[model samples]
Target: MKISARNTLKGTVKEIKEGVVNNEITIQLAGGQEIISIITQTSSNALGLKLGKAVTAVIKASNVMVAVED
Candidate 1:
């Protein structure tokens, strides 16, 4: 599939937390870092996400905020 997001990271499904409306998904990147995404339950089921499954995290955002500790 074609996506407009450029920040696509390949990762493996680490965990899946199911909820009534949404599902929390965690993907572990190559360097051991993890990214979490909350998607609708229907979408989650449509994708058929499971542990150890390889997936790509498509990140498309208008603004990303960053902060530094004092």
Candidate 2:
């Protein structure tokens, strides 16, 4: 599939929190980093998301905030 977003990362499904209308999915990348995505329940079911399943996280945003402490 073609996408405009470039921030795609390979990860494995770590957790799935199902809701009535939406499902919250957590993916664990290499080195134990984790990312969470809230997607539609229909889409989640279509993808058949489950634990330990390999997936890719695509991040698209207009603004990303970062902070550092010294």
- Model 2 spans > 4 angstroms off: 61-63
Can you write out model 2's per-residue Cα lDDT over 10-55, one digit (the tens) per residue?
A: 9999999999999999999997999999999999999999999999
Estimate the TM-score of every prediction: 0.87, 0.88
TM-score of 2: 0.88
lDDT of 1: 0.91
lDDT of each: 0.91, 0.91
**Candidate with the greatest TM-score versus the true structure:** 2
